[model samples]
Target: SQQGEEDPQALSIQEGENATMNCSYKTSINNLQWYRQNSGRGLVHLILIRSNEREKHSGRLRVTLDTSKKSSSLLITASRAADTASYFCATDTTQGGSEKLVFGKGTKLTVNP
Candidate 1:
């Protein structure tokens, strides 16, 4: 499957703690993107790293990509209650002339203050 699947359907943490999630895919991809969703709203793009890249960081969020292993991980350091949301990893597969993104089921993170 080209779709990415994230481990740990849900996570709970206290404020100022760290949260980590892992994702695994079954196909080759051009790039991987991580997104965050609040409640029932649409997803917001957090970061995107190409296949040629290994690791990328943005603010308190860090992402690591391993194309050879077809896996990736997302880490949030010093998590806050405001960071409680659903996180998803999406893969962009456009080799077949179909440019589409397949999203994972997502990991629901709950931050307790």
Candidate 2:
């Protein structure tokens, strides 16, 4: 399968803390994307790092990719209560014109005030 699996099915943290999640895939990929879903709302794209990239950061979010090992990690620093939601990692196969993304089960993050 081209899909990845993320560790820690659920996480709980206090406001202002940081959270980290790890994902591992079974096959080579073209790119990996991280998404955040709030409650019943649609998923919002957080970041996308290609297989060639090592690490990328966005504000309070940090993502690391290791293509050789087929693994990735996501870190959210200074998490707030509003950050409570589900985080998902999606993998895009390397084949050109393939826009399909296989998503992981997801990590449910709960931040307490």
Candidate 3:
């Protein structure tokens, strides 16, 4: 959980606005994935962008991965109240000679109608 760091730990935006969250990592990764957790539910997969791919989009979500900078960003356009949740960026990274999926603390987003 320490391998990745996310900025703007909390964000509030009006419905239909765009919410952008950024994440930075410490080590090399293969596939960077974004997830959304709503309150008590488990993590829900949002998008997965490979290191070779610069950008990927799914529905209103757009994800960008930059291996060079060791960073990634998740953008939600036309945001709705349903989008209110904690978004986290996870990466498969090597640690202590073993590779594991590590997730950032996450950015809690609140979309108001």
Best by lDDT: 1
Error of 1 at 12 (Å): 0.3
Per-residue lDDT of candidate 1, residues 1-113 (tens digit) = 44899988999999999999999998989999999999999999999999999999999999999999999999999999999999999999885798889999999999999
Question: How much lDDT does each candidate structure score?
Answer: 0.95, 0.92, 0.92
Candidate 3: residue 3 lDDT (0-100) = 79
What's the CA error at residue 63 for candidate 2, in Å?
0.1
How far residue 81's Cα lies from its native spot in candidate 3, in Å, is 0.3
lDDT (Cα) of model 3: 0.92
Q: Write the per-residue lDDT of candidate 3 for residues 13-46, one digit (tens) a residue.
A: 9999999999999888978999999999999998
Off by over 4 Å in 1: none
Model 2 agreement with the true structure over 30-93: per-residue lDDT tens digits: 8999999999999999999998999999999999999989999999999999999999999988
Residue 26, model 3, lDDT: 85
How well does candidate 3 match the true structure in TM-score terms?
Answer: 0.94
TM-score comparison, 2 vs 3, better candidate: 3
Top TM-score hit:
1
- Clash pairs, candidate 1, are none
